[model samples]
Target: MIRYPAYAKVNIFLKITGMRGDYHTLSSRFMRVKNLFDTLWFEPKSTPEFEIRGNFDCDVRSNTIYKAYKHLLAATRSDKLSEWMETHAVCVDKRIPSFAGLGGGSSDAATFLRMCNERLELGLGVEELAEIGANVGADVPFFVYGYESANVTGIGEVVERFDEPLLDFEVVTPQIQISTPAVYRYYREHLYAPIGAEETARLESTPSRTILASMTPTEANDLYGAALGCYRELNEKEGWFFSGSGSSFFRIKDEE
Candidate 1:
């Protein structure tokens, strides 16, 4: 049985650059939450079909892991992947909170794709895997690259590794409900004022710690306003930096 970790992540800073079709383009720093992650592995099962044992609230069709499987299969057209699944079942030990702006689902999907590539000897490079992961979800590409810190841009299809100390973060997710689509929709309709390109370049180049100290929660994350607009309960994020879309917030560990 091969076990792997699907790590959680926090957007140290998320700034919307523009829009491509209905999706919002962004240039943001994605830092892996090293301490928090979900575990995945393949266990022996005689089940004659694809089996995923997990705490997922959604069904197979909506599951990101399943979607990854389908995409991988489609991309490779390899019978080995299907044949291997027939003997072993996929199991996920989930710890990351779903819909909490932690990239739990995307991480899981990306991890699955990586696992397949490694185990099957698919000969797919990092870039190839990232490309495949983009089909799964926007966030999956970042996880596919498996970087400690990266600048994700261009609707999340572009990921560039950023050099920085992996600072520990204090992550919190409030029970208030929020969706990425809902937040973007509200932002587009009610509050859509994008920052200038010159400012965006400056923010992306600045260190995350400095930004955390200088910028307020609203200033750090462009989606925070829309999040507040969509869910009135999320009015003030207690002046902490907001993560992607909504509901979760984080700060450097032990920083005042």
Candidate 2:
């Protein structure tokens, strides 16, 4: 029998820097939180079945946890990777609020991948694990690599270690949920714009810190306008910022 503690994370800062032919280019900061998590328990089984139990409303098999396990089995070709991996019960002690845009689901999937790799002795390298994680979801790679802080980019695969001190922040979410695919669809259908090569190059050249330093608190969240258009309640908040093309709006207040 095996159990894993899946942690949750919050994006300290998130920006869509540019869009690539295959994926979007991004620049953001990430922090693991002590507050929210989900648990995954696995044991030997005759056939593969994933059971999810907790606050999550999504289907178990479709959830990243199951997909992550399947990906490992395919990559490592280990029988235990498939055998014990079969019919696992996910007793998700979910504390991270759903639709809060806190990367809770992605973190859970990453934690599962890390623990399963260890239990099954897959000997998969970080990059290989990250690649497998990417197939599971865009943000899973970040949790697999577990860092205090990072400058993440390139569909959340390219993570650069951050040397700056960790910033303390508080996150707030309204009673709304914005699906990632839905947000992307809205952008494509209504707000698509041609790549602004000059602007993108300029944005990339300046350090993210430098850019962030110049912005006022109220001016954060570039996606707020589009997100509000999707969910009209966003306009009621005076100084809220959208967290990752989300219906979740937040304001960062330093911990005193």
Candidate 3:
């Protein structure tokens, strides 16, 4: 079995760029955390069904990896994908925290998709895999592209690689389980103030390290306030920056 590392990511900056229908469009810089990742591989299936071994609270049907599989099958009815899964289980050794704004689930799903594409020889390109991933989750495409840093926009479909210095990040995910949809709903109903095109253009052009130096936690991530308002348990510390929606905070590894 070939093992792949599904790295966690931090939002160096996440800004709300209006809404596209019910979806909240965003312009965010996704930076991979080098040391933190989940391990995914294929192993012999122990039972009669498609099995995933991981430390997940949700059942098999509810898992995003399964969703990726279903979507992959729908996109390309590859008999090889179906045949391969019948005997081998998709296994994950999870290290990234779930629902903590770290893109753990999305990363896992993307990794699984890549594994399927390579193992089953699905012949899907990065863009093709990413399109399939977008259906799995908003953050999955970032992982699918596998850039060190990238600007993610358009309700999470647009991903352009940004030439930014990759800095080690220290992540802190509270034991709190944040519901991303709930936070977005709260923001939509209560705290929605979308950025205009000029500001969006500025954010897209700026480098992440510069953004970190110039902005505070609340300024860096638009979802931070809504996440705090939705989940009272999430608190702001003096120097930490919020990633994605909520529950996890991060900082430069060497920052004092």
Q: Considering every candidate listed, which one attains the maximal TM-score?
A: 3
Give Cα distance to truth, residue 254, candidate 3, Å.
1.5
Q: Score every model by TM-score.
A: 0.97, 0.80, 0.97
RMSD (Cα, Å) for all candidates, in order, is 1.2, 3.5, 1.0
**Per-residue alpha-carbon lDDT of candidate 2 for residues 24-76, written as tens digits (9 for 90 to 100):** 56666665655456666654344555555567677777777778878877887
Q: Residue by residue across 86-138, what tens digits does model 1's lDDT show? A: 88788999998888899999999999999988998988999999999999999
The most accurate candidate by lDDT is 3
Question: Each candidate's lDDT (Cα)?
Answer: 0.87, 0.65, 0.91
What is candidate 3's local distance difference test score? 0.91
Pairs that collide, model 2:
49-87
Cα lDDT of candidate 2 equals 0.65
Assess the local accuracy of residue 132 in candidate 2 as a C-alpha lDDT between 0 and 100: 92
Off by over 4 Å in 2: 1-4, 43-48, 188-219, 252-256
Kindly report the root-mean-square deviation of model 2 from the true structure over all alpha carbons: 3.5
> What is the Cα-based lDDT of residue 100 in candidate 1?
85
lDDT of 3 by residue, 1-256 (tens): 7899999999998888887888888989999999999999999875669899989989999999999999999999988898888989988998998888999999999999999999888899999999999999999999999999999999898999998789999999888999889999998899889888998889889887788889999988989999989888777888999989868999998887
CA displacement after TM-score superposition, residue 122 of candidate 2 (Å): 1.8
lDDT of 1 at 163: 88
Listed per model in order, the count of residue pairs whose N, CA or C atoms clash below 3 Å is 0, 1, 0
lDDT: worst 10-residue window of model 3: 45-54
